[model samples]
Target: MSTSDRTWDVIVIGAGGSQAQAMLAASARGGDVSRWLAVDRAWRPETKATTEALGMTTTALDVLTSPQELRELLGSGRLVANLAGPYYRTGTVVLDAAIETGTDYLDICDDADVILPMFERTEAAEKAEVRALIGMGSSPGTTNVLIRAAVDYLGSAEDVDISWTVDVNDMTDAAARHFWHCFNIVDPDGTIHPAPSWEQLERKTVTFPGTVGTQEVIRLAHPEPITAPRFLPVTRCSNFGAITPIESLVVAWSLAFSVDAQRPRPDLAEVTDHAIDVFRTYRETRPATPRIGSGMQIDIHTDGNGLRFSAGADTEMAEATGVPAAAGIVLLLDGQTPNAGVFSPETLVPADFFTALRKVSRGGGGLELHRLVNGEQTERIRIRDLLSQTAATPA
Candidate 1:
């Protein structure tokens, strides 16, 4: 095939956001540059410069409304790393195209509604010989893997608690959409649950040391609760999002109320866009302290042999999200994942996922792995140290 007609080894959708950039950079960190490409509806100069600097070119392909175009685009790529969201709207479109075109896929989707439906496409993906890994980002991705690690450590898990702190100082459309979607969950009563929820608040004192230490986290229906139980044999699973800059809670609730009251509204995208613009301007006038970090923690409760234990991993969000995502892409490209099927990160990522991720994130002695027996901390491990042990051991 001519160079113009050749398929790209990796195609990243939505190349504008920080997370997407991080993901793309991580993908390029230890891989061939000629085979990677980035796609977005349109490119800002900075985004173009950023991708170019990383040794990848950019293209403008607005395929959101064009399924045939999406199919063709995905067909021309070996693996598609979709970073566009709120994924409730764009996920299935790209995923459907990937399966139809026999293209492997990975996404940082954390929507509970999208996850179950994505899982339902398993048969189709398998039949098409396409491999897919869903929710491969921080909270759901890293948390899910950590919970599995804990489960293995405890023989089995009884309960799993996932929590993360998202500092929304950026005030960009991407950040706005993230918070907006968090409140898009429909309750059993058919009402939209207000997020940054004060009613269902949980006061978590610091158990781990980090930037997000000691905060009031609220219940924001996340995919981890819905999907983690399927793999871990847990009776209870819950996920929480603790938002920084407490005032943002008001903004989240207002957006939720407006969205809920206008049920059947087709202009939801416009609304979010407007809110983002408003917040962006507000942020410009009142610049907040630049946040240096964000993190995720997974705490698992397990009972076996009349004893209870807690085990988990704690790492900054960048390593937690970007590294796993990059690792998934590497595994997919390296044929380390399943032959064919739609699967969650926890399901397909091998035990070496952390090791692969640590290498990609360059997280030397950074990620803390811990296990507590009956509330008394017993084991503490650094990820780099753990990986060294893994590497030294015979397979």
Candidate 2:
């Protein structure tokens, strides 16, 4: 598309944590001549001020009632980066707008209920020629891509298993609160759906990787469970929880239980105040330990031909979450994504995108892929072999 056709190189939909990271990364690339627009339910004066401080523009757009307005605002932007959430409640409308406008769409969604409907909309999106990528954030985003990368190394993957954990405290003030609210809404019944870690009917367990051993992790239903099975022929696909500690999980669980624990109601002022309090507490109690801030650990295991292939990474949560989505945007803008349909990160994003992402991840965080044969672990493996293995394996 010509520069005029792509009026805005990137149009970011929300002024939240992940959106900030995305805008920063895109701007840093510098040559693309990109402009960012931050839109939210209410005018976030603080976020508007922050974006202006960074030299960007901000707009106030209510996601619920502004489709034509959003379409008009999007104009000729080549892509839309959605950062709004409790996605199960508020994501599809934006996706619908993007599809109608024929603009490429991407979001950092991790909600299964939200995604299943989006996936079902793929044919409509394709018909409209709109490329929509879902779950482009950390866990559902890079974690999914990483697992696919590792499975490709094993020559043939018979089954695939994945795990990811984050210290919720590592997120920015707004992000932490957004996550808290989402957790509360999803798990309010005192039972986290799709348990954090489960095996059998996808049984759940908590185990630490490498030196830490495994700790008790609650099983929660995650989008990955739903998306992976539909796309990959693996017999079993599951996600496990590994939050900071039992204490942290307990606190989170408690908040999930309390009526208004993390809900973003009462008023914006109250939400903001509560978010600040949570941030301050995490800072005071956790401090800024080198490895603690916001780190993610992802492990993928596949068994085939009497061999096992696995890959895992321990890195800053922000970078892990931001980079993959940024990379996906790059691919989408460059006309690299093959289809104009709704798809999960792993299903649509190519393997090379991860390789390109690693090159740019130099100072932020590091990613490693591993291979294990007959119960032995090695630091590296071939990507082609891994994909070959998964492809060769029976569904």
Candidate 3:
């Protein structure tokens, strides 16, 4: 029942350095920082110093190549945060290792193609008595948990619409690659179609909090529609979002069509570089597009009654995504969540989720809630005030 002393309480796989750092900071805020480990494919002096600032040790690792070594370091601990990306490639690899080593797992996986396959591991995870939580990042993360809360608050849940927006200034190579690769659609019944995520993009307007005001969003292939139907009775669920400053989007889309069309997609570094050049070029001439970070709005309806929740304004991609993931981590560490089975974030207790998020994010994650009566905003409320109604309102 014992392994080497190299074990860690939590290991943050730094495929996305920003996300990994955010998680480390959050963990430091939540509890002991000594047991945390920051990992990447190669050692970078700057990264090592960053984690050290947060009081955590760092190491370089290619988990894909060194499974046994990774397993040893993982050491069947509290959990492994798979902050790696283009989840289509790295999701299952880290998850398999986590399950093999009897370590709990979490990730911000938003790829449509991977959810069903991961869920298929439910039996395996439960049998191994290890838990796994997927899609715990911003949109799929906070968005999914809020949907469950709204469903409970509104007394019924159906016909959910989730929309998200991220400032182009915060975009990363992995995020950009996901934008192109996530073109495949997932049905409410868990059937992923052979359609493109951007196929027939429909533009619609949504009002987000603070500087986000109202912005146009279109349907993009995401995991919500694929995974939500497995738990909620919503006849329809879909994901829509964009990396803003539509200026850069044009160049990105143009490049994506060419890059993705190649039988062997070119190194995504090309897309990231092109995106930066276009945004930098336009920033000088294009009218200002506020760098207010990212925002998410989820519309939930049940028996025609609707409710909406949103948070944004000056929050970057890493914090927006990593905070929720950190909250999920705290729950697992403190035994706030069950220790068996593979499941989505929505399955976690909403109040506990928000509570953990509030602690890690240091201010409730900038969340605001509202009640929509007959499709019109009728009342405004706070998360604490709304959660107070849980006991009074019979589920």
Give me the overall lDDT of model 2.
0.58
Question: Largest TM-score belongs to which candidate?
Answer: 3
For all candidates in order, the CA lDDT equals 0.66, 0.58, 0.73
**TM-score of every candidate:** 0.84, 0.75, 0.88
What digit string (tens of lDDT, one per residue) describes model 2 on residues 1-395? 23346657778776545554554454445334336566666655665666666555666787777778888766667788887765766678888888777788888887655666787788988898888888887768766665555544433354555554565455455545444444421321233332121122222553444433455554544667666656654456655554565456555544433424433356755655664576558646764543433333444445422223232345556666666677777767666665668877666444556544654454434334455554344557555555444432221
Least accurate 10 contiguous residues by lDDT in model 2: 194-203
Number of backbone clashes in candidate 3? 1
Q: Write the per-residue lDDT of candidate 1 for residues 4-76, one digit (tens) a residue.
A: 3547888888866667888877777767666787888878899889888888878877658777877777878
Count of steric clashes across candidates, in order: 0, 32, 1
Q: Which consecutive 10 residues in model 3 have the weakest lDDT in total?
A: 386-395
Candidate 1, run of 10 with poorest lDDT:
304-313
> In candidate 3, which residue pairs clash?
183-197
Give the Cα error of residue 49 in candidate 2, in Å: 5.2
lDDT of 1: 0.66
